[model samples]
Target: MDLHKLYHVHDFHSRNFLDTYFSSKPDTPFSHETLMYPMEKFHNAFSTGDIKGEVLIDISLGPIIHHLYSAQEYFRDIILLKPTDHCIIEVKKWINSRTGAFDWSHASTFVTEMAGKSDQCEEKEIGLRSAITHVVKYDPNQENVTAPIELPQADCLVLWGVLDVISKDLDDFVGNFRRFSKLLKPGRCLMYYGALNGSFFVVGGERFHIVKYNESNLRSILSDEGYVIRHLEVSQRIIESDLIDFDSVLFCTAYKEQKI
Candidate 1:
């Protein structure tokens, strides 16, 4: 079966994913793993000041913007690249503050409190909304993912659970990574956050495929692609849920050393 075809047929539900993984449940192992862990990782990685940049290109798995709350403080402009219109529309809903948008106040509040500015939760959301300047569609199979538009080589590129979802195998993963690298300046940073050893995730009662790879596989791929790993962190799964099967989560920051 063509995985891409399955993807379109199932049609990823942005709201379903958000509610399933990022609900405002306090102290549940699921929330701790999916929500708090990623937020904390982003906050810690960006706080180092090594990832600061003028423009940040975000190619994530869905319309999720919770991870970008910390990044908005460092990057002047953010461009979101989505593979599906469903994801793009969901993003615009939040950005435009339209009706029925996924509520992200809980995420913003968590991020603000982490930074010791609990009073500025609304301010954080506003900053992130202002920073996201573009939400464009992209095809990972294309030589130029955002063809004809000719986006500038960004100072930083952030990938959150995108490669594994789009990649069918190791070769596909390598090719996709190379294509995404073209959007970043040489020696610039790439922040990656993805599930480790994940095979599939359920959304809206439909199962979607994901490439299964371990930390070593990821490290080797990055190295072969001329990326120098600066920081890498792995968190073990704390909750067992039938909605998804993954052993752990991996988050890392690497610099592209050689232009492709």
Candidate 2:
């Protein structure tokens, strides 16, 4: 990974994602209708009791604010686990409402609309801010990813957009899944989201690696590890030269009977 081209999630959002894939205008001006589909599915899952959880632990989240609108309402405490110092600092700055935090007002508004609310965008932000109870450093390389902090197993483990960038191969994916599984109590929920068929993405004019995989690989690995997929949703991105390099997005809700 070229250090210069690589950046945190917030940086990626500001640089390439915001206008190219998730533009404010999803109609005649631009098309981001595909990106919004997963958020809506997640929103509906949280709203309709499709995903049940008390404590939700987010693994390797690098300052992502796009999908938490409904998750904040569902989980009492959203613990964001950072795998690096830079990501940790960046996340805290936004969580603490420090200066120049990345703007997520548009995302908040979109989520609010998905939840059938016509207003109260500020309240939604406040609600999310309040729900974020802890920010802890996690080491993805370790067998126990969230080491040094002996936390009780969480009700749910959420892995989103991290596996592709972090995992080098199929084995790495399985290893990380096991590490995350250790954080979830037996029979607990697992919510996963990821970009499909993505090999690399540019951030701030720098390119970073993404381990491309198809639906078969994802479902096979998850099933092998004992997760029962209850709900699954996939969105195919419309191919465009200016748009981000991802073929599709996968969102799923599953539960583990026993960890492998």
Candidate 3:
């Protein structure tokens, strides 16, 4: 319900979103294991024998490209959609290769490292920049999130923390994802990442609320949305630290089942 609190410039740090989440700093809650889990699962699902296609649509990208490092290897075009101007501008800076763009270089190395590939951070940056052809502002309040701007149905949908955190309730969560699934081509794949049993997190010393959903609710919603689970994993917190307050994280790779 409180979507606007931590996203404002004063609360959110667009500059450090990547480094902050995927940190080498001492006792970063997003440990090497936490960061590596999704990447490894993605590598198995997609990098190994997963489907490939042209467009990858991302909503509420926040400021991290960590999820898309290996994905850029397969997707010819990546579209970054943001809910706010600040998020859009920050992502555009990196897309345009500006001088002070947030460094996503670490994402490339870490993603490739997870896949047992040699260091290719520079190549990874080039790949992402070249693949991401559009950085557009999306209005979620509209009947269609991409309204006033027509976008092709994507081959794959990438959602990280958007559906779970933005919706005010379970019904809102269901409706939001339903809209998102419409943007995906039928039978195409969807990759999702989000907090499990999390309601709020600290950013800039302020508390931000997130929708709390469990495994059963998530499965029911996905099934209602016509997704057939190809892979699913839940990683519980191995240790307690700081910055994040979620008990677990959900990683899912599924395909949109075609209507009969």
TM-score per candidate, chains pooled? 0.94, 0.85, 0.90
Winner on TM-score (1 vs 2): 1
Which 10-residue span in candidate 3 carries the lowest summed lDDT?
A: 2-11
Clashes per model (N, Cα, C within 3 A): 0, 1, 1
lDDT of 3 by residue, 1-260 (tens): 45534342233665656555666565666754346676666666677746688899877437666677777778888988787776777888888889888765655677767666656667877887888888877766677787889999999998888876567778988888887888899999988888888776666566666778988889888898888998788888776766666788888888999989
Q: Write the per-residue lDDT of candidate 2 for residues 174-229, one digit (tens) a residue.
A: 88788878888888888888888877765445566677788999999988998899
Model 3, position 182, has a per-residue lDDT of: 83
Which stretch of 10 consecutive residues in model 1 shows the poorest summed lDDT?
1-10
- Encode model 1's per-residue lDDT on 86-199: one tens digit a residue: 989999999999999999999999999999999999899889999999999888878999886889899999999888788887788899999999999999999999998888
Worst 10 residues of 2 by lDDT: 2-11
Better of 2 and 3 by TM-score: 3
Q: Tell me model 3's lDDT, rounded to 2 decimals.
A: 0.75
Error of 1 at 202 (Å): 0.3
| Candidate numbers sorted by lDDT from highest down | 1, 3, 2
